[model samples]
Target: MYRNLQLLRSIRYSYSPPKASVLLDVSNCIQGLKQKLQELNELKVATARKIADYDPMPKLEVKMQEEGFVIKVLSQRSCQGLLVFILEAFEELGLDVLQARVSCADSFTLEALGNKISIS
Candidate 1:
């Protein structure tokens, strides 16, 4: 009788379901880590693309004035090169740009008379 009782107890213990709560918690943690890593990678790629899109030329802002035209050309290009290009373009169009003021930056802004000037 005692042997039967011991055998029944062993069988009950062996058949008990294993607790899975700890395993589930570990799986959730791993999944969260994976999601965080993916987000970081996306952020890195976006930052790289933004950096690559940077323009080295200065922003150009052109305007006109009464005494001929005031050409304010802001650019990262060397002053001589910028002046040469501007003068060449003006010459090509047969419009003389006078009194140029240049500023330097990452991009250029040129403000000059837009082919609508009356030169005496």
Candidate 2:
């Protein structure tokens, strides 16, 4: 057809594949960007599967108190340096520790109690 000849002429002059033609450069579809996207997708899927294999942990709940605050931290197993972080946060706020208690059970539950008073 005359249209096919015009498309061929455009391809020849521009050194690009004709959009209306059945011929296509395979390299254009599987370029470096495609390879990188495939790798990224694979990595994301693997990380998600690995994360799903772990047990789900509960979030921390803090209740305001007249003295300071009562914190109830629910975790599947142990507190991963959370108690230390809590103490450091209280210290950063210039709160002096009045009393503290940490209780653990065979059910792999950890409860930390901290009673702090503001020096100021």
lDDT of 2 by residue, 43-68 (tens): 99999997886676655676667776
lDDT of 1 at 45: 99
Clashes of each: 19, 0
Model 1, residue 44: displacement in angstroms?
Answer: 0.3
Displacement of the residue 25 alpha carbon in candidate 2, Å: 59
lDDT of 2: 0.60
Predicted candidate 2: what Cα RMSD to the true structure?
10.8
Candidate 2 lowest-lDDT run of ten: 103-112
Expressed as tens digits, the lDDT of each residue in 1-120 for candidate 1 is 545444544544433233344344445767999999999999999999987776566655455555555556555444547667777878876776544444546455566653444577
State the local distance difference test value for candidate 1.
0.60
